[model samples]
Target: MTQNQTHDPSGLSQEQAKVELLQLQAQLIAADQAYHQDDTPILSDADYDAAKRRYQALVTAFPRLQEIATQLDTVGAPVGSGFGKIQHVVPMLSLGNAFDDGDVADFDRSIRSYLGLDANQPLAYTAEPKIDGLSLSLRYEKGVLIQAATRGDGATGENVTANARTIADIPQQLQGAPEVLEVRGEVYMSHEDFAALNARYMERGGKTFANPRNAAAGSLRQLDAEITRERPLRFFAYSWGDLSAPLGNTQSEAIERLHELGFQTNPLTQSCASVAEMIAHYRHIEAQRATLGYDIDGVVYKVDALALQARLGFRSTTPRWAIAHKFPAELAWTHLEAIDIQVGRTGALSPVARLTPVTVGGVVVSNATLHNEDYIRGRDNKGEEIRDGKDIRVGDWVQIYRAGDVIPKVADVDLTKRTGEDVPFDFPETCPECGSPAVREEGDAVRRCTGGIICPAQAIEKLKHFVSRKAFDIEGLGAKQLEMFYGDPDLPIRTPVDIYTLEERDAGQLAKLKNRSGWGDQSAANLFAAITEKRNIALGRMIFALGIRHVGEVAAKDLALHFGSWDELAKALDLARPAALAHRSADMAEDQERAEANREGRRAKIKETREAVLSRLELHLAAREAWEDLVGIDGIGATVGLSLSDALANAQERAVFDDLVGHLNISAPAAPTQESPVAGLTVVFTGKLEKMTRDEAKARAEALGAKVSGSVSKKTDILVAGPGAGSKEKKAQDLGIRILDEDGWLAEIAPK
Candidate 1:
């Protein structure tokens, strides 16, 4: 959308620019939703800014076109459906951006001209690092923290006051503050915290995020605030939204007042008297970016005078009184030494470009993602030309850039520098790890190997997942030991079952292990003991250890709670497998071209699909209506059910599973210990609880063997009502459901 994109204003007619503007708005909206609401970004900030700039430039050229856009003033995507949304009194405005020195100079000049001041007139502005994290607003009423919301679409936000109260940095009560103050800030995670949290996730076999910004956003957006409480989130107040009374006449003074009230405000903020000082401060912050410990993509400059800021007003999307000086994208040209295909735990064949050593954004990057086959073939998803329409080769020079402190990516290929000996890479058709057929389903972007645990790479990864913290969690066994033994022919820890009998299998090999590098006799025995100790495990842990696709810790626990024991779970899964498979097949056949014929043909197609599913699931229908029952579970969806079906139906996987089960003791999830009368019953809590927070109440209920549900149903055995409870209580009475006031519930759960 920037004039830089097309390089000529005359070449683009007003109508064409309007069309481009419309397209850009749609794209920006989608991108914003993906990044801000979904915690997933389809495009980098660099690309987004370019599109935004183009839109802005188009509107500036065609002033009449401004009337058509409303998103021009939008800050972030509107609050998503995941959380309760709250409206904002003052819109959280986004800042204009300055990508280079010329842009910065122009910004200063534009401001002075708008105020009818001399070009050399001093303009005091507040400069601070622009934290790349979730924007939040904290509202305090009568010097008491009352509400917290996310910067959703600038005008509306998600209420996260409970979660905000959990962060130690955010004071629950503030002193010496305005009666009604809405402090705007960024919710961020430091690099150390981000790394630690990511390590914990990896240890638990949970998905890890790309960067601190993403981690922070994902943490704050959790439906369960307890999940957000567990994350290492911090807040830095830098601005204000709405205030009952003015705290200060200047921006810096207001920020200082916030800091004085026990709020965590950035200490690096400085007052710049001129554009030179602003640019200097920007460079200073840019120089320290590598050591900041948190992610910051740029430096923000705001007009210090509150009155001036108000007078300057705003553009459709950004404040005219403020602009952000973005740091240059770190990129380096390096030789594409080789292209390597790595088989991930999900069996995805990801292409990685091995590059000549190059430092990007202060880190030495030796590899970058090639993305997919389309990227390698010099085309985008829509088959449009890219990488200058030149295919990348091993000997070609490529540009690697680290965008906004995330993973490095090969941005472009230098076709002119490609050596004559360079040849296009031929992607493999079979799994490089196990020789299994690699498949690319229709519409799938990446090819995945059909091999499950048979592939050594997949096996090792799965075994590592089995021993993860959320799975078996063996004391002495870890990823390193698993990989070491997976490579060693003498080791008995090749499979999960092998661990159970390791003490006996390695009795003579103990001394040998002691002699081997990085191992000793005592450590080996400790590992063996640890393995033996985990032989008797809860059903959920056993299920998680199996590494069934989409069967995470939560799903495993859900299944264990429902099925109780190993035999029961195994029987249910076996019966459910066929139904799940057939249902998935029918679901995948989205095209109705076959039904284009007459009524009989249509009926036959429908009957064929239905019969095929029922025929495969005939035995399972008698065994708990397998697929339907599975789909009804809280977390289980059609996709997950299908994955479970695949795992259970495969003969190799089943054999391996049974063999592993034979050596272990799998029990039901532990039953209640008579702590409460309602132990093992489903409980529903409604409204606010004075004695404890919602999280605390839920935790106590779960500890007492009650499944705490969000809503009351026929399955709900107990309904606990607190103050303000209305609908749930009325429903409980109509259903003749047992009801308890908060105090009554507490008394019932008390030790008798």
Candidate 2:
């Protein structure tokens, strides 16, 4: 989309340049959205920027493109409308990014100089990784999540309540929280999940996603619940918006308060006293980005003090209090000698470009994903074949770059450097692992081997996922344990059932197992007990333990809540299988109808299906429901119900499950209702509270079902203001509100 800058040797008219510039601008914006928001980039950043520069030149020359395209205008407006407009309690402003160590140091100097505070004045900041995903706001009233919206225009956003509810880390009901609160954070996919998803996409004849961000956006934006459910998305709370009362006097304290309120805030965030230390933290994260499990475009630095931040706040869009320090993008050049096609866990044959080792950033690169045959030969003037290019050959010497230093990709190629010895990459005709005939589906790009469980890659990854911490959480037995279990002939541990059978291992063989360095009698006993402990697992945990392709913690919880028991859930999934398969088989079928029907009938149909399946399958649906009901409240959704039905539909798996459940004793989730001493009351703390800080006072108030208002109103039931409470004290007196100083406020809430 870049305007042709070649002197227009033909002497093009101004109108032509203007037209080109506008088109280029549109293309650039679309590419940015795809790359940044959606994680799929149609153009490389370099290509996109090149286009932008060309557009900028024409805009500069004609000036008409500027008026028409307004390429330099602010970001796009927020879209969607699920939230009924409620004014943000605190402005949810954007952050200005600082690209390097110098920028961070300069930010520190600016804050220090602006605040007129010394180094010892305690400028506490809470730094967290800037998650590269979609931003959202969750509003809670009376401790329950009422609405969840996207961060559209900093003011209004699209309502995404259903999707938000699907995120497990976000609580449905707040515990020890304010009357009104808004939690903000990003929802993202783990790198491993992104890789898997991309593999699946290519295998299914679907367009391969560019990155995790695009995958997340595409998944979340899908109208179908099933699609969202299938995505491996997670939420990490970085900050908040609005509160009935100030969370903390300082940024560090506010983060702590958020964590205490049962919100899943990142544990890695820290406070730094100086810019030097801040830079250290930023660099450390940059160095460790590859191991962090998710992507972060940069690190965010914010002024520590709430009062100071308020004093020096606001710009047109970004807050003066906060800035993001971005790490430079990592790119590397590697020689492409060969391209290898490997079958994935989902049976997708992915083309990988094997490269001669080249250093990019700090990491050495030897391979890059070709995506598919189309990707291999796709190249523009640049040698790289990505979304913007059309196929690359095996012999091309590809220039590669890492988008965030975490994902290595081919950037371009030095075709002149190509040794003419290379050959065109061939699409695989059979699965490399299982030797099964590979077939590319109608729309799929990569061919897939329908090997299913027979494939080693699929079986291994599935097993690893099955015992993951969030799932079964079998201690002492991790990926290594599972690998050994699968590989060892004598142990022969293959499934969850195999773990139970471990207790019955022959005494003669027991000695051999114990002799293994990491395993001993006690360790083996613990593993068996842990496995046993999960028997009769909570319906939700059981669903998660199964390691279905897309089901996660939150979805599992929703399924449990909706169906109430394992039997009910199993029936629902069974019914969904036909729909999923049918939709998969039909090229023109609209998935939306099936999705909607599944959503509407999720609860009712689950109950009906449970009754029918229980009679036919002879599973104890009533007992399961009773167990679920006794465990406390649960939430169900179409995704979990479908997964459960699909998983249990196999008679063999069901038999294994029956045995697994019989031995497991996972109690239902704890009851939601707990009796707290502080409930249904109004309390306020003013001035210096001696027993605790202002944060502690506010936390206690909110915990006790009392609304904590910032300033006194006539409606204020009790006001705890101390010695220096000035105007707020007078307001309380004028409003005839009960006023309690520090000691008085403490005494009332104090446990004798």
Candidate 3:
């Protein structure tokens, strides 16, 4: 195993391993959904790989937990709902990753051992750049294009035939193609084209993608083929999925055949006779990566002989004959000019390092995220020393890297290169934008501005977030437009309520929007129409658009589903406020007690004061029940529940919510479309689920319209218990909930 694949030295018990495994599984699944389905990735490729490696290592260490490691066998995200689904004739399996030379050597050895060949025996392998773009499979029948689909969850994919036809590189007809051929390739955007597209999008006041891969994927997956055609997308056919007949005897020959058939194959592909040659070719590719004009994350290698590949066969989610050797993150050294604090929509005072312009991974980065004050202090959350405890200071030399080819991050500081004049960075104790007290709460890494809507930066960022794609997604009101309108005195949109009343307010104003610089009569009218269209919004979208801290899209959806409507949700949150406050006070009291442990008098006095506060702000039965219900929802937990309740409890914030809802007709959460035996039932799974992974079970239940909860409650209609079921099973029994074994539960939710 490589360094990145190293497992923890301290052994974990079976229960501990299972807990960690489940957590990892959830995180990985979320990452996959974000990247494949949502076109937004939260974790960097390196971090994601590292996490997967750890998860795999844990499973290997505890073979008993292997049955629950189903996510490891999954190839991609589920097919998106936007397009028609197509089942692939041949599953588009993912390749196992090799991070270093030792891994490559091991891969070669494994193949040789499997083939019963000596180490000195010759083994030809074909190597090519692993393009970091959207995977597409083009099906051709009798030398004519038939269908095109994206690689969704390996077996099934989204049909994008119309969009595929728009790409100039994808040929409409192939003269020498077989009767049935499924050509697999990558749809990519060149660096120049990606830059141009982003520039155009910015000019038009639209949101731009993070990278070329995202740009290409988002472009190709457009509902409108005209949009896809407008995007400069290119394709390079490198592999074949379903073929009526064999293309060639060797992988290299097959690729050459693809090129001959009028499909663009990567020209740099080479056939290597040995592992050493393969490594040499990989190095050559890495050297030319920046100049390639397109993004390639790694190099893929496959057994040359078709017969040998067939003999090698496959793993659960990857072909045994092939492996992708991934590239390490690119790093560059630059001078740290200064550190600046930027307030986010959540009022997080994020420290960013302004650097002397330096190119890293082919992109010139002038700024990098410092993460937080802890990062600058060279200490982790546990106060453990990192980077040799070298605190970052202005004028110090810094090593920067683009993690996953997306976010620029400061990796390390060069203490030796730091000038004597350099001083330690002092993070601000007040909001720079509004001069309000910026306080760091207990256990929170970031210091947040308490200015709320009074903070100009936070207000503008929140407005931008409110109109973001995942939020209201107003067509004419993008980040640029919102910023412009926020600064304009005549057409100021300071809050979510302001957005709805803009048209009415504008009608009475002398400075009409139609007379503005970028606004024509039609455009102005269209903006109003778009805003009006969103007047009747979904409960989940409205909650997310409110920009409440810790309450993201997923949390908002959970809340919406639980409460069903705005009225119920608002009432519940309002009642939950007192209990949530009491909980916070108790936690603070505990902290105070811990701090004053040596001084009994002070501790007693503090405890008394806390008791008095709690008693005076006594929560009624309804309030206590409300708080329980809010926290009881699956995935809400105490933290999110507190945030939600607090947001509604604050007088100033409550006014905003009230004003916003007053203008809009907010709809209740939509009911599940499909009716099944488990529909409308709250199901909880506990102990070891032998039949399927926890994630799989949750997804299955949700698909069948069952509400899957983490904890067993009075609301739980059924509890599925497996081997070693403990507290949850006892709780279910106490609550008089229906219980079922794994097989029994499976039978209950079976097709009939």
Report the poorest 10 consecutive residues by lDDT, candidate 1.
Answer: 1-10
User: Each model's C-alpha lDDT?
Assistant: 0.73, 0.61, 0.78
Query: Candidate 3 residues 1-752, lDDT tens each?
Result: 12342223123445445445544554565566576546566653434544564555556456544534535555566666689999998998777667678778988988886777779999999999998888999999999999999987688999999999999999999997799999999999999999999999999999987778778888988999999999999999989999999999999999999998999999999999998999999999999998999999889999999999987776556788998887886789999888988777678787778999987764567877676788789876568776788898999888886533224566677777865887888999999999999998776667889999989998997787687555787877876678778888887888888998888888644235546647766777888999998888899889888877666566777778777788899898887788888988877877777668646544343454655666677669788777766777776777777777878877888999998889888888766686689877888899987656675677778778787777776778999999999999998899899999999988997877
Which residue pairs show collisions in model 1? 1-54, 2-54, 72-316, 72-317, 73-316, 73-317
Tens digit per residue, CA lDDT, model 2, 1-752: 11111222123345334334434444554554465445555553323333443444444355433333333322323343323444455555556556456557666766765666556666766677777787778899889999887665456566677767776678899787889888888888889999999998889999977667767766765656577878888888777887887788888888888888887777778888778878888887778888998877778888788898886666435666787765665555666777776655345666667889876643356766554555566632224434355346766767776433123456566767656765666677878777878886543455668676667766665566566544675655666677777777887667677777777773545456766736766676777777666554677667777655335454565445445677665554554455433323332233344555678875222223333433444434443433322222112233333334455666766777778776676554443354444444445556665555565566566545454544454445777887677887887788788787777776776765
lDDT of 2: 0.61
Choose the strongest candidate by lDDT: 3
1 or 3, which is superior by lDDT?
Answer: 3
RMSD of 2: 22.7
Instruction: Tell me how far the alpha carbon of residue 644 in candidate 2 is from the true structure, in angstroms, after superposition.
Output: 4.8
Worst ten-residue run, lDDT, model 3?
Answer: 1-10
The candidate, 2 or 3, that scores higher on lDDT is 3
C-alpha RMSD in Å of predicted model 3 compared with the true structure: 10.6
